[model samples]
Target: MAAESDAPERGAGTEKLWNETGIDPVELHLGKDSGYTLRAYRMSDTLPGAKAEEPEPDEAEDDDEDAPEAEADADAVPEDPDADEPDPADFEDEAPEDGDEEEDALDAEPEEVPVFLTRKGKLLVFREPAALVAYVRDNDDHDLAAVDEYADLQERVTEDDIVCDEADIYELDLVVANLRGGQEGWEPELLIKAAEVGRDLGYALKNDSIVSALAPGSPLDDLDEAFRVVAEGGLKGRFAKRRLKRSDPQQAAIAWRGVIAKINDHVEWRG
Candidate 1:
């Protein structure tokens, strides 16, 4: 009888905590350590409200008068016969400018969001856990090995695994600097890897063929041309010897370094 009486008091305390913090107790329990917790609130809950009051007769009368005045003014306006006649152009919608279309395309591309790993090696990708689960389920036969490898990798990765937050852009800068300085032991493979990383991060243009990776008239176009000249004999064979033979290697290096430095300067670190 005493335990039954205490149950209501405990329930009341839980309700009080939930009302104050806006966190559901069930969600807190379900998310534990291995899962993620997402809480969304309605806009009305966050916004302040005006107190309800009796209607003002004078204000209501003023609004009624204004509505008729607006309608009367709109009706009083005279229309020209020429204005009523429509041209063929008026029937057709104006075609969007190429530049406007390009800007829209760029805006439509989704921005990359941050992802985290739970202690139990579960990947917590923002707003896409269900999609990820479905993908894993669909490709179980072909992707089981890859899934296991990723699980192992996530287990080893911690907050300390981050060497530099800007390592993606920094690696490109470092590779370009080495090329500029004519530093020995900087392999062609390093440049290839940098290109791949840059493209993955949306910094570099995607190209179908390796030779056409860098866009024309881009900041890195000169560097791409230089790379092409050096790699004419192919990527693997005598790369260092061919790289040294460029007519203005120093100028190309300086340009590449400036472009990368400008990019690094604009990078922001978000917590």
Candidate 2:
């Protein structure tokens, strides 16, 4: 991959780095020139172990001290007559129907999961998809048409859009690296291969898995959409077709590079 120093400023806190599989957490440091140096550490290294057991209290002394106090406290206060009586308002309002439980269950707020966008040496984190989308729209200089397509794509996304499992991690890494190389070094062949790999990866990883593995508003989501577009002979497909039709290898490379760059922003570090 061609080296580029486009990483955003490092935020404060202990950042957890992951392997290419986006599973195991590792300590990662950026090299002076290119790539990352990773260090693995066990969980025990950071967390404390179980505390030593405390001494047991004397059973005989405990019982003797509690007997008199328990009897005295119990005798001190008599139960109020009104304490047993149900509130008049409670009866007037009537008991809650069975559907109340279902209504309450429906009304309960859904849990929010955090999302992260990780690049070569930067990590952008967000809790909301809209914020991530807004950040991308404001900061990146991408094709407006492509951006709109991505926005429309989001609405159509279902739960089955992304999937990740232990077996697919290695393949995922290979495909992502292929795409990254196409973007960084402007290799047309790699871009084509990346697109092909993307289709398979898309099938392996549904939308939810992709978002959860990377970040909710990640560009990888758009890349998947781009792959679909290319497959369906859309704008990206036209760009690819034009690139392939060009006679000059250098010109073809340049054209393909532009096409790759358009979708490349979404490719990010999963770990």
Clash number by candidate, in order: 0, 10
lDDT for predicted candidate 1 compared with the true structure: 0.38
Which ranges of candidate 1 are over 4 A from the true structure? 1-78, 82-86, 93-170, 181-186, 202-222, 225-247, 268-271
Roughly what TM-score does model 1 have, to 2 decimal places?
A: 0.34
Residue 180 C-alpha lDDT in model 1:
62
Candidate with top TM-score is: 1
What TM-score would every model get versus the actual structure? 0.34, 0.20
lDDT of each: 0.38, 0.35
Clashing pairs in 2: 18-271, 161-206, 161-207, 162-205, 162-206, 162-207, 163-205, 163-206, 219-266, 220-266
Cα-based RMSD of the predictions, in order?
20.2, 19.9
Clashing pairs in 1: none
